[model samples]
Target: MSVDTIYKVILYPFITESIASLKAMTNLQGTAGDPFIDNVDDFRFKGYAVCSDVTGNLDGVIMMHHYPETAIAIGNSVCEKMFDEKYEHTEITEELSNALAEWGNTIVGRSTDLHGRYSLEYNFSSPYFVHDVSDMAKYLAGVTEVVTVPITVEGVGRYYFNLLVRSVDYQQVGIKREESRGIENTHTTTLETSSKILLVDDSAMIRKALKRYLAQLGYHNVIEADDGASAVTMVASESPDFMFMDVVMGEVNGDEALRQIRAAGSNVPIVMLSSVTDKVLVDKCKDLGISGFIFKPIQADSGAEIIKDYLKIA
Candidate 1:
């Protein structure tokens, strides 16, 4: 059977971006096994899970299930990255819970960005944690199908992304659903479309999504690099007119790469992309002279406006 469009466009992309986000946040390599489909009743929780309710174009539950050790390990990694802490955790703590929750939020939030592009906007409630989940029948009351993808992070162990799919409740979402494109569907731009653009991010899925947005705005001369080091090299070799760089990357981060590019005397209009909201980090990026900022789960309209302003497309 053909996969549902929701899975093909939103859920599947969510799974891919989840792995990318995991690696970006923790500097750990993550790999995904084939996705398994089953009834919601078959949902298995190892020792811990974080779950959030998704609403809007699609409504259902989305979760990340992990063994206790896996949660502790990954949470510690996030702590080290965010706070520069060296202490390791053997049990779940308030700090660790927050880190895992934020991580879950990032994965779901980025997936929703793809929703807007496909005209399937969605919003997710804040995630909550569960220990040794034995029953989810309440949450799965009306849900029928569950798609679980197993993701492993080598020494850190494995976790699963489980999506409980359900049809949207028109009354609850408070809007009539329509198949046709409305006024917001138009993504046309009067700006020149021939600018050679560079997209730098470790996630192939994220690059592909952004490329689609750029294409919709008439930009096609695009090149991609999966990490900051390659981005630095491509900036010299490709000489793109504009660039979009991710903040957290392997090798060199967006800020350091920006410093290198400027040091090389290249004044390309570069916009920084990230989900991080740390003011200090944002200020540091400004100090490095970013052309603009596009928060993660990037909005197409906002990105378009930033590009137009930087390119002076009047």
Candidate 2:
């Protein structure tokens, strides 16, 4: 479909009075010292997949992909703004997951209504989450073409709204055909690197993206921890030179994990990564003596510079 049409379909559902109000409040809050605000608008897609099938005239699937953290963040934002309930952290509780799934369903249902303007009738399946992209691929097996629209939910992060259509001609949908290009070979020298870094987060996408970014910057000795508890254990066993930790995580959070590590007297320099910017939490992290704090959807070059500077990796 035309990019404009795709964009319209993707964002049409969220322009309602209730959601628009929330968006306004979120933008007004900004990334200031508010604890609820984290790195919610990072331009990276590091999360899980929520998909719903659209039948009838539009025979395709609409998928909303978000990082686990991003999903929780969005859910919490919705709860607080729409339901007048406050969630301290964006942990994936059952209630939160259900809320998110329902939100997805609503969006899909509403967007399908727009199809009627084209004299097309559409129906959608219940939304479901998939932990991995590969698992999501199974559902898209017969899809001939796909259109992806990226949108940022204030205080939630970036999300990909994808539509997979079956037996659709690309030209009819305004997609152009282009010749595939081969990879180019270029000689490069590896910079001397020695930091053993640990990346801790629940999102596999974040871990992989950060790991790949670090690798490209010549920081190859990287380790990963999926949660705060595992991060604590890895700290003791791995003895990493530096750590990048997500603040809102399962088991022990970044702050508590840092507390445990400090209580044991291991002064490993750690940088906190988060989408939330709660002042209380930031002060608590400062008290725990964090080396630095980096927002999520980390930029490779700048992040590499921060690491090198902190580790003195000249």
Candidate 3:
């Protein structure tokens, strides 16, 4: 859909009712130009996705956040809320939480489509519930930049239609960079765990780019080892948090390095990162217990996500 065509208001009543309740505002029957919305005074609803910069402040920890995957999952759930099971909810919080996490996973993937202006890079961290719309700006006080897209599910049926980015930036996200662009200058998540990252790759270019990306993801400590043998040494001595292994190298390929590491009793997540898409070679790594596999030319955001999700970092 055109960015201008996407607004903040749903044609369906069921969706509108929930949006009103979620925002704790008066009952809204928003159909056309700006229906009821939560968070900011300027934000209204169209179909899905809520996009606005109501306060005219676009710096520090922009919350381009989406958790509507919960709405989709819960919509299909076989509960009183879903299929009308017996006794209908003394509690449904656990299911809702799981639904929310799944929503984050799917929405993050869908966002890759709109990452033209800025890289939407982040893991699903503990969310701060802000009831008051005025306090949303306060909730995202520190950090840099705030972009919020409300992925709204409109209509009720066997399968609801999803609008992942109901509203995106009306204007281009101000971006200027040396390399490939389309990313906010600053987005730092609070990393609760302190684990060392060992990046194993022969290419200097890949290593440098990855190291910078890790730092951008708020991973302060990352150690880079050039070859598989050194990486194996780090596995034993450094006891690193995780390893990113490049598949092909002059002396030893990733396959050899992986088997050696596994033999050494290091169960740390080992992700085989390679440009080689050959099906047979890829399968071999799978047999050796590679924690994750990502192709070469990995985007900074995508790489960080594989790491966070596979490791379940808090």
Candidate 4:
């Protein structure tokens, strides 16, 4: 994806929310610099980078690169806000790493809410801290794209917010330049309420969220499965017109369940949902012939659009 496409579709929402989050949590006024393509092959970490792996509608890693002083300042600020504690350290300490990782989780987790507003879908991993390494490129092995935006935190110095993508299709993910221009003008295609939709996930919260979103989109004939094994049984019995399933689950993971369903001769439009973008898992799902894929922390509007695409509105 181009830098602009990446910015508008993904980074913009993240950076906007991130800056706001930084202000609220650390009470630090921050500004985002213009985003630019970074040379991944020759990239170097300034001191340390806190990284989160992202997958689904998009697949990549996001890094918050910081200098020693910047990391210390931000880490201390976060700790003070969270635990009323501050750190005194010349180098990265375990406590500092824990604080940064927790802050990173808070920032990325909050960003998903805003992503829904933009009809975007993607999943993010828990943040982990990485120190400056001699082989930076090797550490980021599969990343094909990189975009960097500098965040200038008042008095704390500047830290870089970087997006690194393994692979992504802007158009397929509904963020193409031409289409993005008219996104606001697009209208929702309402599907008939008679259609049965299967919602499968171990989390009642997720099932509840999807039920609400489906209700808004005029699909009320919904079925629920708490796990993948149950999902297979429900498909045979309910014969749902559309289905949404989480990839990772207990008893039977989604991929195995999908394989069983396919083996039993069912071709229902099943969309796989997950926060993981592991190539092996994605490729396995594709080979099993999934109808579509959605990144976790699903948004109502974005999920509705995907459902519409698969089960065309009547």
Scored by TM-score, the top model is 1
Q: Global CA lDDT of candidate 2, please? A: 0.57
- Model 4 clash pairs are none
Q: For residues 1-314, could you state the per-residue lDDT of candidate 2 as single tens digits?
A: 55456434433342331143234222212121111111222222346667777776567766677777777777666445433346656578866665565455444433433333344345566456776545654666676656655555655556665666663222122221111111111213222467799999865645765676677668889899999889889989999987878776656788899999899888877777664444467679878877666543233334455444444321
| Per-structure clash totals for the candidates | 0, 10, 25, 0
TM-score of 4: 0.51
- Cα lDDT computed for each candidate against the true fold: 0.68, 0.57, 0.44, 0.70
Worst 10 residues of 4 by lDDT: 176-185
Clashing pairs in 1: none
Better of 2 and 4 by lDDT: 4
- Model 1 misses residue 95 by how many Å? 1.4
lDDT tens digits, residue span 1-314, model 1 = 22344455445766777787776667577898877786566665677787778887667888778888988998888656544346499998877776776576667555544444444456666456677455665667787677777898988889888777786532111112122111121223343688798999865645765786677677899999988888889999999888889877657888888888888988877777776444566678777766666665433334444445444321
Q: Where is model 1 poorest over a 10-residue stretch in terms of lDDT? A: 177-186
After superposition, the stretches of candidate 4 with alpha carbons farther than 4 Å from their true spots are 83-87, 116-122, 132-135, 172-314
Predicted model with the maximum lDDT: 4
User: How would the candidate models be sorted by lDDT, starting from the highest?
Assistant: 4, 1, 2, 3
Q: Could you tell me the TM-score of candidate 2?
A: 0.42
